[model samples]
Target: MSEVQDSGGEKKKGKKIRAKKHSTHIDMTPMVDLAFLLLTFFLFTTTLSKPKAMPLIMPDVNEVPDPSKQTPVDDEDAMTIILSKNNRVFYYFGIKEPKVEQASFDATKPNSLRKVIIEKKKECESRLKVGGKTPNERHKVVILIKADKDAKYKNMVDVLDEMNINDVPVYAIVDITPKEIEMISGL
Candidate 1:
């Protein structure tokens, strides 16, 4: 409830008359109820933010997979990429006795990692015998990524971005080996 009251009282003739004063009262219960209702309405109607994540698809364990869809990759078809300190990248084409050649993350240069992966992808795709099978069934590039202890996490993220950019079909983040560490230590 709101109310207004006049403060003027009877004045004596010899005394100066005082200015009239008015008092106001405002009830805040309805305003508070309205504010809470608006807050609750907005809270219930708004959607909460979702967590960001990278996707990882795993095979269904219960369902039997058809063997026709699977194509085995040769050892020669494998490509290994190693991430070292300072965002450096080392790549080799095969599994055994890899030359351990260094490639830059730079996109502008000819020997950049993207160029190498794209070239290797094309080569492996060419080597697959897609005789009667559909194009998707053909063998694709398989990349193995390993990171050194000294390597920065950003390098791994960059390599993952490259994989996504090139649409690489098969790849895994494998653990680094001591032998591989020795190979790149001098470089």
Candidate 2:
């Protein structure tokens, strides 16, 4: 709101020869109401986006296998991927042991960890098909992800992304054993 007034000095002649001046006032109530309405509309209609998160299913600690009753995962059906420092990737077809072959990460070439995952999945499917197993009985390719203590978190994330891209059904992050560490250091 605003107002303007004129002083009585303009009639100093005392002849009263002046038109009456009106004080100018502007009502700001409507503008204030409009501003509040817009604020309320935006507050009610605007959507707050939620943050995205990757889905990770962790195994329970109590689910540890009993050595006597547990059946070992077949070497042909399991693939282990080792993540190390400098974004290096090493893999073997089975559990970590001496004489296991090593492979480096190669995004441009077809012979990458990604390729190994795909091939292993196909191989598992074919083996199940030949065995006259039903679809439900077919074995899914199991992937073991082992990260060295010196590896970057980014490298682990990249490997996880590769797992998702390759559609691996069963994969777990396992700690590298002493023997596996020695094998990596020797390489």
Candidate 3:
């Protein structure tokens, strides 16, 4: 077999130099532009939903007691405050069914619940005093709060501040059932 040789003594092997048959070069400019466009689209168009929040730690389902066997809070000094989505404030003496109180709130004027809670605390204290007991009596002032999921966070905070100011320490955050929460959320 005969081999072709260059002037510099390099062997010219195989057929004459041929152009590549199937070049697979990709232009990254368009791809990189598309990636940046997608990133900008996500950054501008995405809407983050508000996070769910609560002050008190919620009880786990496993730790929750049986609803049917739950003892009623019959203590007259016990108070349950419910903040409905319609901005209504209900005060319950001892049961879950809270009585709607004619409470007013001004969004411009903050801490509006303070006055109402002060009055309610006075009334509760007076009732306990008439019953030959002081305000500091153990479990004499339980203030449970049941707040609507859509209720303003500020309102719940105001209620908590009022309870703290009134010295009603014992409190719990009532949780709604899954069904009730679904209904409230219109899901």
What is the lDDT of every predicted structure here? 0.84, 0.76, 0.60
Every model's Cα RMSD, please? 11.8, 11.8, 12.6
Tens-place lDDT per residue, model 1, 65-172, is: 888997666677789999999889999888766888999999988889999999999887766454636666555789999999989988988898899999998898
Q: How would you encode candidate 3's per-residue C-alpha lDDT over 1-187 as one tens digit per residue?
A: 2343353344233332344457779889999999999999999998888686545655566876888986455466576666667675555465544344435455334435556556556666555343456556423456777776667777678777666666765677775445334333431
Better of 2 and 3 by TM-score: 2
Candidate 2 lDDT over residue span 1-187, tens digit each: 1222234444454544454367669999999999999999999998898776878887777987778986467666788788787777887775544355566467667667777778879888676634555877666788888998889987888888888898888888988988778777866
| Candidate 2: residue pairs that collide | none
**Model 2 C-alpha lDDT versus the unseen true structure:** 0.76
Q: Which candidate, 1 or 2, has the higher TM-score?
A: 2
Give the lowest summed-lDDT range of ten residues in model 1: 1-10
Each candidate's TM vs. the true structure? 0.62, 0.63, 0.44
Using lDDT, rank the candidates from best to worst: 1, 2, 3
Better of 1 and 3 by lDDT: 1
Candidate 1 residue runs with Cα over 4 Å from true position: 1-52, 56-72, 130-134
Q: Which ten residues in a row have the lowest lDDT in candidate 3?
A: 7-16
